[model samples]
Target: MVQSIVEELEPLFNPKSVAVVGATTNWNKWGYSTFTSALNGFRGPVYPINNKESEILGHKAFARVTDIPDAVDLAIIVIPSTGVAAVMEDCVAKGVKAAVIISAGFAEIGKEGKRLQDEVLSIARKGNIRFIGPNCMGFWSASSDLRGFMFPLPVKDGPLAFVSQGGNVGGAVVTSGFMRGVGFHRYVSCGCAADIQIEDYIEYFGEDPEVKVILAYIEGLVDGRRFLDKVKKVTPTKPVIVLKPGKTDAAAKAITSHSGALAGSDEAYEAAFKSIGVTRVESPEELLDVAIGFLTQPLPEGRNVAILTPGGSYGILCAEACATEGLEVVKLPDRVIAALDKVFPPRWSHGNPIDPAGDRNLLTYLTAPGKLLKVDEIDSLIFMGFSGFSIYTSLFVSRESGEGAPWISSREAFREVAKEFTRAVSLKDTVKIGQTILPIVSGMASRMGIYHEEDVSELTEIIAAAIVSGRLRVPFLVSAFLPPGSEALAEMGVKTPPTANEASAHFLVAMAEQWVASYKKPVLTTTFFTVDQPRLEGTHYAYPSGRHAARVLIKMVEYKEYLDVSQK
Candidate 1:
């Protein structure tokens, strides 16, 4: 059903011939940047349309869009508010596949602009054409070499794709996310959305093979039902992360003014997102963090998280933070404690977050998470602080070469030497440095932190999604997307934590409940055998949407298969 629309949107993403209406020669204007970006990225034919000049940006310019010699697959409209209607008429006459209107004076400017926006919409619909925005930045696809955006996105191909309702946030995501190594397959800033809504992009991007994860920075949704339907269909295959602003009434009002979006009740939006299996992050930082997590972290086995750190206080701090988020600072199980005694000294604080008090080796930092992952008690880990990366980095360089210590011309290095010479490496000093500069090094960038954080996070979600769908390597997972019943969790001997560490287990268990819930109602009074393996993937049922009788028949078939497997 959506394939038709996907086909319709194909040329927009990768066009053969693009015509720029209101093309300009000035570098400062958007008309210049938007069109040039296309020329810069795409190797296809580009035509510029301008009234006065013979040429713009060294490309042959035409007075009207209909004068282009070839079929215009995509048009970038950048004319004035009053001139858009005429431009749309010419675009329709030319029979272009789609046009991206990059002008600003649309419905967001109020009634007069709303009427202008409607005129363009009416023409596009009647002309059997589709367009992107009349007040937005437009879109880009790395695979197609299609950079229709005003921004020069990083030259990288990432598994993530983002669609933002606001152009500012879209630009911000491209610029800021690049520094953190987050890239995109495609990025679209859906401005005004006069012709296309957020849901259309969701459906389009969901079908994108290059896109493994979808991140949306939405101010509001025009059609919530359509959004829910499309997201429900797509989420089982790819994780959709949305950062919806306008949570407050004040912000909601602002959202309407910005894009004429109907920012409905936040509560309704939350429930709708939840029901459709969308992961909603509250802030930009969480959006990026969770996006990275989805891209890199592993599926956690259980809810009990063990914080691995060099300092006891850092471990305690992590414990406090984890507890606040409903995570369990698990007491180190007897087996793990017994096992750690070999590597840890006699004074090791033998607890859940087994901080071997005096262990200062960076190798210890490197090998801790995998060693901990072996224990069934721990499902995930958050490494609190790390070694002085700058100091460790110095070891590989020529700076600390000649004497016991290198001749330091820099005052800062000499100051450090004097301070370190006079003071001893005390417990308080370790905690102090760990809390201060050491955290910056290990926060997410240090070698050990990057490996563990990325590994544990991506794996946990993948396993979570796999456990729910009974399909490993299902494109993406929603953090904490499940609501499994207590009976099932009890059967697995799992105590679901309030925080997100156990989210994978919760995700799988919840999906299983959704599939078997209706069937189990009939046998509520009876009991059945259960599986106890920490990962109960067999229980995760990938039940596609169907009628009630059809579901029952599926369950019956599944039961027969289960019996066969059990017998074998």
Candidate 2:
């Protein structure tokens, strides 16, 4: 009987019972890793198929998959390449619906390997069984709690569905994305494409309701025409991002051996991707940046953007970047400039890239973006500068008696902190404290009781949820100098002074996420300082540079145009 794509792939993700065809007791072996990892809270029964051992990892062992008493929905084959064909035959006899072959030494090795891979594929096909790989790491499904991968990943339930031709690369993206607050609904390591190819997974993810955006790392294509046909149907409704690395001949040669995939004409692939509205990124960083932009921000109505920077240089830099990326650095209308004048000082740039010229007021930083976005000419806004909350919060105030000791008496710590915050930061003309800067201020709002230290993470989520839930109609990308991850910030010791830039990123995400949700726009951010580790969490990420933000916006613009055209 013919099966739908979901029907064909469902067991691969939500299998009721699984058999580890090469279960082993050796810690170094792939079979051991696969079976042991699957036992970590997999939703259903996991049986170990091994002849020598009575049991493996506390489960009864079966000599062959067919010997298992229960009907197997999925079979995980991690035996030698020479033994994979036999394992497939046993899986076929057992009426297994899907299999994930994690063993190596397949087509990537050479002609003999290719012949073996073909033989295994033929057996699986004849038995109406679909499989993941002849040489793969394995797959992970968040919905089913299926952990079939060899490597361990701190999987979080999210909207992204990532498929990669390279296992290590896929693992890296998944790991990096997790550190940066991106999560995955499903992650598939497509090894050698012996049977189940990358395009097949794309079509399945496209149909899966859990997925919002699809990301792919392609070394080469198995069938270019089939990929195009399948991807074309998925792109109009959802975004399909691909990072193809075979642009140069040297890279193409490396790719050929990497996954045994044919590195087709790079130019032809580019044209096809463009025609089908697939967002092609240059690197893994770009891939994640574009993915975050899509998930967190709304598409801009047009290419016109208004930039608000804390310094003249960032304004100039961002303006140039936006123009170079084919986005219009829109000229501020007289009314818009007039509106900004009320918020910024006399030295403000007063032009398109509105430079506050070292305006240290929290009110000004919070108010600037809304002013520019209100203009009809501006479809998007880029706030570039010292926009982190650490600058204005009392967290940096000395808690100990030392060189940077607290200014107030110990009896009145909270009150003194609140008083000191008001004094250091200019809250002048702040008509309504709660409406103006409730949660983004990142301190205890003693008067309004709107913010507290304990609620920092929750408030941050509120900000992100606001942006993600369509708070802004146009995209809003912010930049910071040194935005640390949430863990890094939380682990920060009682220091003399906080990393102002890092704190800026911490608060920038909160403000941006909140503002985006309020306005129903996308708020992407850039960072200047190096965060040697991944620390930021939730939907907010501090991209390495402003150019990264620009690239994200441009890609979003391109996707928006494609969607618009497709709808028409």
Which one wins on lDDT?
2
**Residue 155 in model 1: lDDT:** 38
Candidate 1, residue 465: lDDT: 32
What is the lDDT, from 0 to 100, of the residue 508 in candidate 2? 55
lDDT score, candidate 1, position 272: 83
102-195 per-residue lDDT for model 1 (tens digits): 8889888899889989999999987777888878887877867888876455635677888888888777777656655557888888898988
| lDDT by candidate, in order shown | 0.61, 0.73
- Model 2 regions more than 4 Å off: 386-390, 394-508, 532-538
Best by TM-score: 2
lDDT of 2 by residue, 1-568 (tens): 8788998888889998888888889888878888887876787999999989988866789888888888999998888899999889988888999999999999998899999999999999988888987678988999888889885677777899999988888888888788777789999998897887789999999999989999999888778899989999999878999999888999989987888888889999989999999999998878877998898788888898877666677678887888899999887899888877765678888798777777666545565666666567888877664334234433333223231222223335534444443342343322232232343334332222323342333343344444344432111211111132322222223222345344444555567767665565655555554453235554555565567778999999999999998889
